[model samples]
Target: MPLADAGLTAWSWNPLTDIQVMWSYPFMVNAFRAGAVIAVLSAAVGWFVVLRRQTFAAHTLAVVGFPGASGAVLVGVASGYGYFAFCLAAAVVIAMLPGAGQGHGEESALIGTVQAFLLACGFLFVALYKGFLGGVDALLFGSFLGIGDGQVVLLAVVAVVVLAVLAAVGRPLLFASVDPSVAAARALPVRALSVVFLVLLGAATAEASQITGSLLVFALLVMPPATAQLLSPRAAVSLPLGMLIGLAVTWLGLTAAYYSPYPVGFFVTTFAFAAYVLARAARTAATAFGARGPRPGTGATGGTPHAVEEAAA
Candidate 1:
Protein backbone atom coordinates (compact mmCIF):
# COMPACT_ATOMS: atom_id res chain seq x y z
CA MET A 1 0.00 0.00 0.00
CA PRO A 2 1.16 3.53 -0.70
CA LEU A 3 2.32 5.43 2.41
CA ALA A 4 0.58 8.56 1.22
CA ASP A 5 -2.69 7.63 -0.42
CA ALA A 6 -4.04 9.19 -3.65
CA GLY A 7 -6.42 11.29 -1.60
CA LEU A 8 -3.54 13.14 0.05
CA THR A 9 -3.07 16.64 -1.28
CA ALA A 10 0.06 17.92 -2.99
CA TRP A 11 2.45 20.35 -1.38
CA SER A 12 0.82 23.62 -0.51
CA TRP A 13 2.14 27.15 0.09
CA ASN A 14 1.11 26.82 3.74
CA PRO A 15 3.59 24.62 5.61
CA LEU A 16 1.18 24.10 8.49
CA THR A 17 -1.52 22.78 6.17
CA ASP A 18 0.93 20.46 4.48
CA ILE A 19 2.04 19.05 7.84
CA GLN A 20 -1.55 18.63 8.96
CA VAL A 21 -2.38 16.62 5.88
CA MET A 22 0.66 14.41 6.34
CA TRP A 23 -0.20 13.79 10.00
CA SER A 24 -3.75 12.83 9.15
CA TYR A 25 -2.59 9.43 7.94
CA PRO A 26 -2.04 6.56 10.41
CA PHE A 27 1.06 5.18 8.63
CA MET A 28 2.66 8.60 8.50
CA VAL A 29 2.01 9.10 12.21
CA ASN A 30 3.63 5.79 13.11
CA ALA A 31 6.49 6.49 10.74
CA PHE A 32 7.16 9.81 12.41
CA ARG A 33 7.03 8.27 15.88
CA ALA A 34 9.39 5.45 14.95
CA GLY A 35 11.69 7.80 13.05
CA ALA A 36 11.89 10.18 15.99
CA VAL A 37 12.81 7.38 18.38
CA ILE A 38 15.45 5.90 16.07
CA ALA A 39 16.98 9.28 15.28
CA VAL A 40 17.38 10.31 18.90
CA LEU A 41 18.93 7.00 20.02
CA SER A 42 21.17 6.77 16.99
CA ALA A 43 22.40 10.30 17.42
CA ALA A 44 23.11 9.85 21.11
CA VAL A 45 25.03 6.62 20.68
CA GLY A 46 26.69 7.75 17.45
CA TRP A 47 28.26 10.74 19.11
CA PHE A 48 30.28 8.33 21.23
CA VAL A 49 31.00 6.20 18.16
CA VAL A 50 32.63 9.16 16.42
CA LEU A 51 34.32 10.32 19.60
CA ARG A 52 35.90 6.89 20.09
CA ARG A 53 36.75 6.58 16.38
CA GLN A 54 34.90 3.26 16.14
CA THR A 55 32.99 3.91 12.96
CA PHE A 56 34.27 0.63 11.53
CA ALA A 57 32.83 -1.36 14.42
CA ALA A 58 29.55 0.54 14.15
CA HIS A 59 29.39 -0.26 10.44
CA THR A 60 30.05 -3.90 11.13
CA LEU A 61 27.19 -4.12 13.61
CA ALA A 62 24.89 -2.48 11.10
CA VAL A 63 25.89 -5.03 8.48
CA VAL A 64 25.24 -7.86 10.90
CA GLY A 65 21.57 -6.85 11.04
CA PHE A 66 21.04 -7.72 7.36
CA PRO A 67 22.00 -11.33 7.93
CA GLY A 68 19.96 -11.41 11.10
CA ALA A 69 16.81 -10.29 9.32
CA SER A 70 17.37 -12.58 6.35
CA GLY A 71 18.13 -15.59 8.50
CA ALA A 72 15.02 -14.91 10.55
CA VAL A 73 12.97 -15.02 7.35
CA LEU A 74 14.61 -18.30 6.38
CA VAL A 75 13.32 -19.81 9.62
CA GLY A 76 9.85 -18.22 9.42
CA VAL A 77 10.40 -15.76 12.27
CA ALA A 78 9.86 -12.06 12.66
CA SER A 79 12.68 -10.00 11.16
CA GLY A 80 12.74 -7.62 14.11
CA TYR A 81 13.82 -10.36 16.48
CA GLY A 82 16.57 -11.41 14.09
CA TYR A 83 17.78 -7.85 13.70
CA PHE A 84 18.18 -7.24 17.45
CA ALA A 85 19.49 -10.72 18.27
CA PHE A 86 22.15 -10.76 15.59
CA CYS A 87 23.21 -7.17 16.13
CA LEU A 88 23.49 -7.56 19.87
CA ALA A 89 25.31 -10.88 19.48
CA ALA A 90 27.76 -9.38 17.00
CA ALA A 91 28.36 -6.48 19.31
CA VAL A 92 29.31 -8.83 22.13
CA VAL A 93 31.60 -10.79 19.84
CA ILE A 94 33.25 -7.63 18.59
CA ALA A 95 33.65 -6.34 22.10
CA MET A 96 35.36 -9.51 23.32
CA LEU A 97 37.71 -9.66 20.32
CA PRO A 98 40.77 -8.02 21.85
CA GLY A 99 40.19 -4.43 20.76
CA ALA A 100 41.19 -2.32 23.72
CA GLY A 101 44.83 -1.17 23.69
CA GLN A 102 45.28 -3.15 20.47
CA GLY A 103 46.74 -1.72 17.30
CA HIS A 104 44.32 -0.08 14.92
CA GLY A 105 45.35 -2.43 12.14
CA GLU A 106 44.42 -5.51 14.19
CA GLU A 107 41.14 -4.04 15.40
CA SER A 108 40.10 -2.99 11.90
CA ALA A 109 41.05 -6.36 10.45
CA LEU A 110 38.94 -8.21 13.00
CA ILE A 111 35.92 -5.95 12.42
CA GLY A 112 36.24 -6.22 8.63
CA THR A 113 36.41 -10.01 8.86
CA VAL A 114 33.17 -10.17 10.83
CA GLN A 115 31.41 -7.73 8.46
CA ALA A 116 32.45 -9.67 5.34
CA PHE A 117 31.39 -13.01 6.81
CA LEU A 118 27.98 -11.77 7.96
CA LEU A 119 27.25 -10.04 4.66
CA ALA A 120 28.07 -13.23 2.78
CA CYS A 121 25.77 -15.16 5.07
CA GLY A 122 23.00 -12.68 4.31
CA PHE A 123 23.28 -13.39 0.58
CA LEU A 124 23.35 -17.12 1.23
CA PHE A 125 20.10 -16.91 3.19
CA VAL A 126 18.50 -14.93 0.37
CA ALA A 127 19.56 -17.57 -2.13
CA LEU A 128 18.25 -20.41 -0.01
CA TYR A 129 14.81 -18.94 0.52
CA LYS A 130 12.15 -20.59 -1.65
CA GLY A 131 9.62 -17.80 -1.46
CA PHE A 132 10.11 -14.45 -3.08
CA LEU A 133 11.77 -11.87 -0.90
CA GLY A 134 9.43 -9.11 -2.01
CA GLY A 135 10.43 -6.81 0.83
CA VAL A 136 14.15 -6.88 0.04
CA ASP A 137 14.12 -3.39 -1.39
CA ALA A 138 12.28 -2.09 1.63
CA LEU A 139 14.67 -4.02 3.86
CA LEU A 140 17.72 -2.49 2.26
CA PHE A 141 16.47 0.99 1.37
CA GLY A 142 13.67 1.46 3.96
CA SER A 143 10.02 2.43 3.57
CA PHE A 144 7.66 4.58 5.60
CA LEU A 145 4.94 1.96 5.14
CA GLY A 146 4.04 -0.81 7.64
CA ILE A 147 5.27 1.04 10.69
CA GLY A 148 2.46 0.15 13.09
CA ASP A 149 1.69 1.17 16.67
CA GLY A 150 3.45 -1.85 18.15
CA GLN A 151 6.73 -1.12 16.34
CA VAL A 152 6.59 2.50 17.37
CA VAL A 153 6.04 1.59 21.01
CA LEU A 154 8.81 -0.99 20.91
CA LEU A 155 11.18 1.52 19.37
CA ALA A 156 10.29 4.15 21.94
CA VAL A 157 10.83 1.72 24.82
CA VAL A 158 14.19 0.62 23.45
CA ALA A 159 15.18 4.22 22.92
CA VAL A 160 14.36 5.05 26.51
CA VAL A 161 16.41 2.15 27.88
CA VAL A 162 19.34 2.97 25.60
CA LEU A 163 19.24 6.65 26.51
CA ALA A 164 19.06 5.94 30.22
CA VAL A 165 22.02 3.58 30.15
CA LEU A 166 23.97 6.08 28.09
CA ALA A 167 23.21 8.78 30.60
CA ALA A 168 24.49 6.67 33.46
CA VAL A 169 27.77 6.00 31.71
CA GLY A 170 28.04 9.21 29.76
CA ARG A 171 30.78 10.90 31.75
CA PRO A 172 33.15 7.95 32.03
CA LEU A 173 32.56 6.95 28.46
CA LEU A 174 33.46 10.42 27.31
CA PHE A 175 36.61 10.41 29.38
CA ALA A 176 37.62 6.98 28.17
CA SER A 177 36.87 7.87 24.59
CA VAL A 178 38.95 11.05 24.68
CA ASP A 179 41.95 9.53 26.41
CA PRO A 180 41.81 5.86 27.32
CA SER A 181 45.31 5.77 28.79
CA VAL A 182 44.58 8.40 31.38
CA ALA A 183 41.17 6.96 32.08
CA ALA A 184 42.67 3.56 32.70
CA ALA A 185 45.45 4.98 34.85
CA ARG A 186 42.82 6.66 36.96
CA ALA A 187 41.41 3.17 37.73
CA LEU A 188 38.29 3.63 35.63
CA PRO A 189 36.97 0.45 34.03
CA VAL A 190 37.94 1.41 30.52
CA ARG A 191 37.50 -2.09 29.14
CA ALA A 192 34.10 -2.50 30.72
CA LEU A 193 33.03 0.87 29.45
CA SER A 194 34.11 -0.05 25.96
CA VAL A 195 32.06 -3.23 26.07
CA VAL A 196 28.98 -1.44 27.38
CA PHE A 197 29.28 1.19 24.70
CA LEU A 198 29.58 -1.44 22.00
CA VAL A 199 26.42 -3.22 23.16
CA LEU A 200 24.56 0.09 23.18
CA LEU A 201 25.92 0.90 19.74
CA GLY A 202 24.77 -2.48 18.48
CA ALA A 203 21.25 -1.95 19.79
CA ALA A 204 21.14 1.50 18.26
CA THR A 205 22.40 0.12 14.96
CA ALA A 206 19.70 -2.55 14.91
CA GLU A 207 16.99 -0.01 15.65
CA ALA A 208 18.29 2.34 12.99
CA SER A 209 18.47 -0.40 10.35
CA GLN A 210 14.69 -0.78 10.58
CA ILE A 211 14.23 2.80 9.37
CA THR A 212 17.34 3.56 7.25
CA GLY A 213 18.24 -0.06 6.38
CA SER A 214 21.45 -1.93 7.06
CA LEU A 215 23.46 -0.19 4.33
CA LEU A 216 22.36 3.39 4.99
CA VAL A 217 22.27 3.25 8.79
CA PHE A 218 25.30 5.46 8.77
CA ALA A 219 23.18 8.33 7.51
CA LEU A 220 21.87 8.60 11.05
CA LEU A 221 24.69 6.73 12.80
CA VAL A 222 27.70 8.73 11.58
CA MET A 223 26.75 11.80 9.59
CA PRO A 224 24.80 13.83 12.13
CA PRO A 225 27.27 13.28 14.97
CA ALA A 226 30.16 14.00 12.64
CA THR A 227 28.54 17.18 11.38
CA ALA A 228 27.78 18.27 14.90
CA GLN A 229 31.36 17.68 15.95
CA LEU A 230 32.58 19.71 13.02
CA LEU A 231 30.38 22.57 14.17
CA SER A 232 31.23 22.35 17.88
CA PRO A 233 34.21 21.17 19.92
CA ARG A 234 32.63 20.84 23.34
CA ALA A 235 30.96 17.52 24.09
CA ALA A 236 27.96 19.21 25.71
CA VAL A 237 27.27 21.29 22.63
CA SER A 238 28.03 18.63 20.03
CA LEU A 239 25.98 15.79 21.58
CA PRO A 240 22.64 17.61 21.59
CA LEU A 241 23.49 19.33 18.35
CA GLY A 242 23.85 15.91 16.75
CA MET A 243 20.44 14.86 18.11
CA LEU A 244 18.76 17.95 16.61
CA ILE A 245 20.45 17.37 13.30
CA GLY A 246 19.35 13.74 13.31
CA LEU A 247 15.75 14.72 14.07
CA ALA A 248 15.73 17.34 11.31
CA VAL A 249 17.14 15.06 8.62
CA THR A 250 14.88 12.18 9.64
CA TRP A 251 11.70 14.28 9.65
CA LEU A 252 12.62 16.00 6.39
CA GLY A 253 13.50 12.69 4.79
CA LEU A 254 10.19 11.14 5.86
CA THR A 255 8.23 14.15 4.62
CA ALA A 256 10.00 14.20 1.28
CA ALA A 257 9.73 10.45 0.78
CA TYR A 258 6.03 10.54 1.62
CA TYR A 259 5.41 13.08 -1.13
CA SER A 260 7.68 11.54 -3.77
CA PRO A 261 8.08 8.11 -5.31
CA TYR A 262 11.37 7.39 -3.57
CA PRO A 263 12.78 5.46 -0.63
CA VAL A 264 13.10 7.09 2.78
CA GLY A 265 16.71 5.98 3.21
CA PHE A 266 17.82 7.78 0.05
CA PHE A 267 16.33 11.07 1.20
CA VAL A 268 17.73 10.63 4.71
CA THR A 269 21.20 9.77 3.45
CA THR A 270 21.27 12.61 0.93
CA PHE A 271 20.14 15.20 3.44
CA ALA A 272 22.67 13.98 5.99
CA PHE A 273 25.49 13.99 3.47
CA ALA A 274 24.51 17.50 2.39
CA ALA A 275 24.55 18.69 5.99
CA TYR A 276 27.98 17.18 6.56
CA VAL A 277 29.32 18.78 3.42
CA LEU A 278 27.93 22.18 4.33
CA ALA A 279 29.44 21.96 7.80
CA ARG A 280 32.77 20.93 6.31
CA ALA A 281 32.72 23.85 3.88
CA ALA A 282 31.82 26.33 6.59
CA ARG A 283 34.57 25.06 8.88
CA THR A 284 37.09 25.20 6.07
CA ALA A 285 36.10 28.73 5.09
CA ALA A 286 36.35 29.92 8.67
CA THR A 287 39.76 28.30 9.06
CA ALA A 288 41.01 29.88 5.87
CA PHE A 289 39.70 33.29 6.85
CA GLY A 290 41.25 32.97 10.28
CA ALA A 291 44.53 31.89 8.70
CA ARG A 292 44.72 35.18 6.82
CA GLY A 293 43.95 37.42 9.79
CA PRO A 294 46.84 39.12 11.66
CA ARG A 295 48.09 37.10 14.64
CA PRO A 296 47.89 38.59 18.13
CA GLY A 297 51.26 39.38 19.86
CA THR A 298 52.91 39.18 16.41
CA GLY A 299 52.46 41.39 13.34
CA ALA A 300 52.99 38.53 10.84
CA THR A 301 49.89 37.64 8.80
CA GLY A 302 49.95 34.00 7.64
CA GLY A 303 48.90 30.52 8.66
CA THR A 304 51.12 29.35 11.50
CA PRO A 305 50.86 25.89 13.06
CA HIS A 306 49.64 27.40 16.31
CA ALA A 307 47.41 29.85 14.47
CA VAL A 308 45.82 27.07 12.40
CA GLU A 309 45.28 24.90 15.46
CA GLU A 310 43.77 27.82 17.32
CA ALA A 311 41.44 28.65 14.45
CA ALA A 312 40.42 25.06 13.81
CA ALA A 313 40.22 24.26 17.48
Candidate 2:
Protein backbone atom coordinates (compact mmCIF):
# COMPACT_ATOMS: atom_id res chain seq x y z
CA MET A 1 0.00 0.00 0.00
CA PRO A 2 1.09 3.58 -0.60
CA LEU A 3 2.13 5.48 2.56
CA ALA A 4 -0.67 7.99 2.05
CA ASP A 5 -3.24 5.20 1.66
CA ALA A 6 -2.06 3.55 4.91
CA GLY A 7 -2.20 6.90 6.70
CA LEU A 8 -5.79 7.47 5.57
CA THR A 9 -6.76 3.96 6.67
CA ALA A 10 -5.23 4.54 10.11
CA TRP A 11 -6.98 7.88 10.43
CA SER A 12 -10.33 6.26 9.66
CA TRP A 13 -9.90 3.63 12.40
CA ASN A 14 -10.90 3.92 16.08
CA PRO A 15 -9.99 7.18 17.81
CA LEU A 16 -7.43 5.42 20.01
CA THR A 17 -5.95 3.70 16.99
CA ASP A 18 -5.88 6.99 15.15
CA ILE A 19 -4.13 8.64 18.07
CA GLN A 20 -1.63 5.79 18.22
CA VAL A 21 -0.86 6.17 14.53
CA MET A 22 -0.35 9.88 15.01
CA TRP A 23 1.92 9.18 17.96
CA SER A 24 4.15 7.20 15.66
CA TYR A 25 5.22 10.66 14.61
CA PRO A 26 7.41 11.63 17.59
CA PHE A 27 6.77 15.38 17.70
CA MET A 28 3.02 15.03 17.30
CA VAL A 29 2.82 12.51 20.16
CA ASN A 30 4.98 14.56 22.53
CA ALA A 31 3.03 17.71 21.84
CA PHE A 32 -0.29 16.02 22.55
CA ARG A 33 1.04 14.53 25.79
CA ALA A 34 2.49 17.80 27.00
CA GLY A 35 -0.68 19.73 26.20
CA ALA A 36 -2.92 17.22 27.98
CA VAL A 37 -0.84 17.25 31.18
CA ILE A 38 -0.63 21.01 31.34
CA ALA A 39 -4.36 21.38 30.78
CA VAL A 40 -5.27 19.14 33.71
CA LEU A 41 -2.87 20.82 36.08
CA SER A 42 -3.95 24.26 34.93
CA ALA A 43 -7.67 23.62 35.39
CA ALA A 44 -7.13 22.18 38.86
CA VAL A 45 -5.06 25.11 40.12
CA GLY A 46 -7.00 27.69 38.15
CA TRP A 47 -10.24 26.90 39.94
CA PHE A 48 -8.76 28.27 43.14
CA VAL A 49 -7.07 31.10 41.33
CA VAL A 50 -10.34 32.43 40.00
CA LEU A 51 -12.12 31.78 43.27
CA ARG A 52 -9.49 33.74 45.20
CA ARG A 53 -8.82 36.35 42.53
CA GLN A 54 -5.13 35.48 42.37
CA THR A 55 -4.81 35.16 38.61
CA PHE A 56 -2.41 38.10 38.55
CA ALA A 57 -0.17 36.47 41.11
CA ALA A 58 -0.03 33.30 39.04
CA HIS A 59 0.88 35.31 35.97
CA THR A 60 3.60 37.16 37.85
CA LEU A 61 5.21 33.96 39.14
CA ALA A 62 5.31 32.44 35.65
CA VAL A 63 6.88 35.56 34.19
CA VAL A 64 9.46 35.83 36.98
CA GLY A 65 10.58 32.24 36.42
CA PHE A 66 11.41 32.86 32.76
CA PRO A 67 14.56 34.84 33.53
CA GLY A 68 15.47 32.58 36.42
CA ALA A 69 15.28 29.52 34.16
CA SER A 70 17.29 31.26 31.45
CA GLY A 71 19.93 32.17 33.97
CA ALA A 72 20.16 28.55 35.09
CA VAL A 73 20.56 27.44 31.49
CA LEU A 74 23.36 29.96 30.99
CA VAL A 75 25.14 28.52 34.03
CA GLY A 76 24.96 24.94 32.71
CA VAL A 77 22.12 23.70 34.91
CA ALA A 78 18.77 21.90 34.50
CA SER A 79 16.67 24.87 33.45
CA GLY A 80 13.29 23.27 34.01
CA TYR A 81 13.94 22.06 37.58
CA GLY A 82 15.84 25.21 38.40
CA TYR A 83 12.94 27.34 37.24
CA PHE A 84 10.53 25.32 39.38
CA ALA A 85 12.74 25.84 42.43
CA PHE A 86 13.07 29.53 41.78
CA CYS A 87 9.31 29.95 41.38
CA LEU A 88 8.63 28.07 44.60
CA ALA A 89 11.16 30.20 46.46
CA ALA A 90 9.60 33.32 45.07
CA ALA A 91 6.14 32.15 46.10
CA VAL A 92 7.34 31.63 49.65
CA VAL A 93 8.95 35.03 49.74
CA ILE A 94 5.84 36.72 48.33
CA ALA A 95 3.67 34.96 50.84
CA MET A 96 5.95 36.24 53.60
CA LEU A 97 6.07 39.85 52.40
CA PRO A 98 4.55 42.16 55.06
CA GLY A 99 2.59 44.49 52.79
CA ALA A 100 2.15 42.06 49.89
CA GLY A 101 -1.52 41.48 50.61
CA GLN A 102 -3.81 39.62 48.18
CA GLY A 103 -5.83 41.22 45.40
CA HIS A 104 -4.60 44.69 46.26
CA GLY A 105 -3.36 47.43 43.92
CA GLU A 106 -0.06 47.63 45.74
CA GLU A 107 0.41 43.86 45.39
CA SER A 108 0.01 44.19 41.64
CA ALA A 109 2.62 46.95 41.53
CA LEU A 110 5.08 44.80 43.46
CA ILE A 111 4.43 41.84 41.14
CA GLY A 112 4.91 44.03 38.07
CA THR A 113 8.28 45.22 39.34
CA VAL A 114 9.41 41.64 39.94
CA GLN A 115 8.20 40.50 36.53
CA ALA A 116 10.01 43.35 34.73
CA PHE A 117 13.30 42.71 36.51
CA LEU A 118 13.16 38.95 35.89
CA LEU A 119 12.26 39.37 32.23
CA ALA A 120 15.17 41.73 31.71
CA CYS A 121 17.48 39.28 33.44
CA GLY A 122 16.13 36.46 31.25
CA PHE A 123 17.00 38.43 28.12
CA LEU A 124 20.54 39.03 29.38
CA PHE A 125 21.01 35.34 30.13
CA VAL A 126 19.65 34.36 26.73
CA ALA A 127 22.20 36.71 25.10
CA LEU A 128 24.97 35.20 27.22
CA TYR A 129 23.99 31.66 26.20
CA LYS A 130 24.01 32.14 22.45
CA GLY A 131 24.75 28.48 21.76
CA PHE A 132 21.35 27.46 23.23
CA LEU A 133 19.36 30.07 21.38
CA GLY A 134 16.98 27.51 19.94
CA GLY A 135 16.37 25.96 23.35
CA VAL A 136 15.80 29.36 24.94
CA ASP A 137 13.32 30.29 22.25
CA ALA A 138 11.52 27.02 22.81
CA LEU A 139 11.34 27.83 26.52
CA LEU A 140 9.99 31.31 25.81
CA PHE A 141 7.47 30.45 23.10
CA GLY A 142 7.11 26.70 23.80
CA SER A 143 7.23 23.94 21.15
CA PHE A 144 4.90 21.08 21.94
CA LEU A 145 6.42 19.27 18.97
CA GLY A 146 9.82 19.12 20.64
CA ILE A 147 8.78 17.91 24.12
CA GLY A 148 10.38 14.67 25.34
CA ASP A 149 9.00 11.66 27.23
CA GLY A 150 10.75 12.73 30.44
CA GLN A 151 9.04 16.12 30.37
CA VAL A 152 5.74 14.40 29.69
CA VAL A 153 6.27 12.14 32.73
CA LEU A 154 7.18 15.10 34.90
CA LEU A 155 4.02 16.95 33.85
CA ALA A 156 1.90 13.88 34.54
CA VAL A 157 3.22 13.72 38.11
CA VAL A 158 2.62 17.42 38.65
CA ALA A 159 -0.94 17.16 37.32
CA VAL A 160 -1.72 14.27 39.63
CA VAL A 161 -0.32 16.10 42.66
CA VAL A 162 -2.21 19.27 41.82
CA LEU A 163 -5.49 17.40 41.49
CA ALA A 164 -4.95 15.59 44.75
CA VAL A 165 -4.20 18.79 46.62
CA LEU A 166 -7.17 20.55 45.10
CA ALA A 167 -9.44 17.67 46.05
CA ALA A 168 -8.11 17.46 49.62
CA VAL A 169 -8.78 21.11 50.32
CA GLY A 170 -11.33 21.87 47.67
CA ARG A 171 -14.20 22.87 49.99
CA PRO A 172 -12.22 24.97 52.44
CA LEU A 173 -10.37 26.54 49.56
CA LEU A 174 -13.65 27.62 48.06
CA PHE A 175 -14.91 28.85 51.39
CA ALA A 176 -11.71 30.74 51.94
CA SER A 177 -11.70 32.08 48.44
CA VAL A 178 -15.22 33.44 48.19
CA ASP A 179 -15.73 34.60 51.77
CA PRO A 180 -12.52 34.81 53.70
CA SER A 181 -14.21 36.84 56.39
CA VAL A 182 -16.70 34.08 57.16
CA ALA A 183 -14.02 31.44 56.80
CA ALA A 184 -11.84 33.26 59.30
CA ALA A 185 -14.77 33.69 61.67
CA ARG A 186 -15.18 29.94 61.52
CA ALA A 187 -11.49 29.51 62.32
CA LEU A 188 -10.61 27.99 58.92
CA PRO A 189 -6.93 28.88 59.05
CA VAL A 190 -7.41 31.26 56.18
CA ARG A 191 -3.93 32.75 56.31
CA ALA A 192 -2.04 29.48 56.47
CA LEU A 193 -4.22 27.87 53.83
CA SER A 194 -3.70 30.81 51.53
CA VAL A 195 0.05 30.54 51.86
CA VAL A 196 0.09 26.78 51.30
CA PHE A 197 -2.17 27.04 48.29
CA LEU A 198 0.02 29.73 46.77
CA VAL A 199 3.04 27.42 47.06
CA LEU A 200 1.24 24.60 45.27
CA LEU A 201 -0.01 27.02 42.63
CA GLY A 202 3.53 28.30 42.17
CA ALA A 203 4.75 24.79 41.44
CA ALA A 204 1.95 24.18 38.96
CA THR A 205 2.57 27.54 37.27
CA ALA A 206 6.24 26.67 36.85
CA GLU A 207 5.35 23.35 35.24
CA ALA A 208 2.77 24.96 32.96
CA SER A 209 5.14 27.79 32.00
CA GLN A 210 7.47 25.16 30.58
CA ILE A 211 4.93 24.27 27.88
CA THR A 212 2.74 27.38 27.40
CA GLY A 213 5.49 29.89 28.20
CA SER A 214 5.02 32.58 30.89
CA LEU A 215 3.26 34.92 28.49
CA LEU A 216 0.42 32.51 27.66
CA VAL A 217 0.29 30.42 30.83
CA PHE A 218 -2.74 32.36 32.08
CA ALA A 219 -4.75 31.30 29.04
CA LEU A 220 -4.56 27.69 30.22
CA LEU A 221 -4.76 28.43 33.94
CA VAL A 222 -7.35 31.21 34.08
CA MET A 223 -9.53 30.94 31.00
CA PRO A 224 -10.92 27.43 31.54
CA PRO A 225 -11.92 27.95 35.15
CA ALA A 226 -13.38 31.34 34.39
CA THR A 227 -15.32 29.83 31.52
CA ALA A 228 -16.52 26.98 33.69
CA GLN A 229 -17.74 29.38 36.33
CA LEU A 230 -19.91 31.06 33.75
CA LEU A 231 -21.38 27.73 32.62
CA SER A 232 -22.11 26.51 36.12
CA PRO A 233 -22.60 28.58 39.27
CA ARG A 234 -22.06 25.69 41.64
CA ALA A 235 -18.47 25.05 42.62
CA ALA A 236 -18.77 21.24 42.56
CA VAL A 237 -19.97 21.02 38.98
CA SER A 238 -17.87 23.91 37.80
CA LEU A 239 -14.62 22.37 39.01
CA PRO A 240 -15.01 19.08 37.13
CA LEU A 241 -16.50 20.82 34.11
CA GLY A 242 -13.51 23.15 34.00
CA MET A 243 -11.20 20.17 33.95
CA LEU A 244 -13.15 18.57 31.13
CA ILE A 245 -13.12 21.77 29.08
CA GLY A 246 -9.42 22.21 29.75
CA LEU A 247 -8.67 18.67 28.60
CA ALA A 248 -10.73 19.21 25.49
CA VAL A 249 -8.90 22.43 24.69
CA THR A 250 -5.53 20.79 25.11
CA TRP A 251 -6.35 17.73 23.01
CA LEU A 252 -8.10 19.64 20.28
CA GLY A 253 -5.51 22.40 20.20
CA LEU A 254 -2.70 19.87 19.92
CA THR A 255 -4.42 18.00 17.10
CA ALA A 256 -5.19 21.23 15.28
CA ALA A 257 -1.63 22.51 15.68
CA TYR A 258 -0.38 19.16 14.32
CA TYR A 259 -1.90 20.00 10.95
CA SER A 260 -1.69 23.82 11.00
CA PRO A 261 1.36 26.00 10.40
CA TYR A 262 0.88 28.03 13.57
CA PRO A 263 2.69 27.45 16.87
CA VAL A 264 1.20 25.37 19.73
CA GLY A 265 0.67 28.42 21.97
CA PHE A 266 -1.44 30.09 19.31
CA PHE A 267 -3.74 27.12 19.00
CA VAL A 268 -4.03 26.66 22.78
CA THR A 269 -4.76 30.33 23.43
CA THR A 270 -7.24 30.47 20.56
CA PHE A 271 -9.11 27.46 21.88
CA ALA A 272 -9.30 29.04 25.34
CA PHE A 273 -10.48 32.37 23.98
CA ALA A 274 -13.20 30.66 21.97
CA ALA A 275 -14.35 28.76 25.04
CA TYR A 276 -14.53 31.95 27.09
CA VAL A 277 -16.59 33.73 24.46
CA LEU A 278 -19.02 30.85 24.16
CA ALA A 279 -19.45 30.62 27.92
CA ARG A 280 -20.11 34.34 28.19
CA ALA A 281 -22.72 34.17 25.49
CA ALA A 282 -24.46 31.27 27.16
CA ARG A 283 -24.56 33.06 30.51
CA THR A 284 -26.03 36.16 28.93
CA ALA A 285 -28.75 34.17 27.20
CA ALA A 286 -29.65 32.38 30.41
CA THR A 287 -29.89 35.64 32.35
CA ALA A 288 -32.12 37.17 29.65
CA PHE A 289 -34.56 34.28 29.81
CA GLY A 290 -34.53 34.02 33.59
CA ALA A 291 -35.41 37.70 33.94
CA ARG A 292 -38.89 37.17 32.44
CA GLY A 293 -40.40 36.43 35.81
CA PRO A 294 -43.42 37.85 37.71
CA ARG A 295 -42.81 41.30 39.20
CA PRO A 296 -43.47 42.06 42.87
CA GLY A 297 -47.16 42.75 43.77
CA THR A 298 -48.11 42.06 40.12
CA GLY A 299 -48.97 38.35 40.45
CA ALA A 300 -52.66 37.28 40.82
CA THR A 301 -52.28 35.97 44.38
CA GLY A 302 -49.34 38.12 45.55
CA GLY A 303 -51.17 41.35 46.64
CA THR A 304 -53.38 41.97 49.66
CA PRO A 305 -57.10 41.74 48.76
CA HIS A 306 -58.08 43.99 51.77
CA ALA A 307 -56.00 46.84 50.38
CA VAL A 308 -58.40 47.01 47.41
CA GLU A 309 -61.43 47.37 49.78
CA GLU A 310 -59.59 49.96 51.92
CA ALA A 311 -58.81 52.03 48.84
CA ALA A 312 -62.49 51.86 47.76
CA ALA A 313 -63.65 52.96 51.26
Using lDDT as the measure, the top candidate is 1
lDDT of 2 at 69: 82
Cα lDDT of model 2 by residue, 1-313, tens digit: 1233434433454777767766787766777777777887888899888888888778778887888788877888766776688778888987887646364664677666767888888888998988776666666765565467887787788778877877888788888888999999999999888888888888888877776776788778899999887766666667777878888988876665554555667777898899898766655554454345432223221122222222222
Enumerate residue pairs that collide in model 1: none
Candidates' RMSD to native:
5.1, 9.2
Q: How many angstroms is residue 84 displaced in model 1 relative to the true structure, after the best TM-score fit?
A: 0.8
Per-model TM values vs. the true structure: 0.87, 0.83
Q: lDDT per residue, candidate 1, 28-80, as tens digits?
A: 89999899999999999999988888887777788889989888878987677
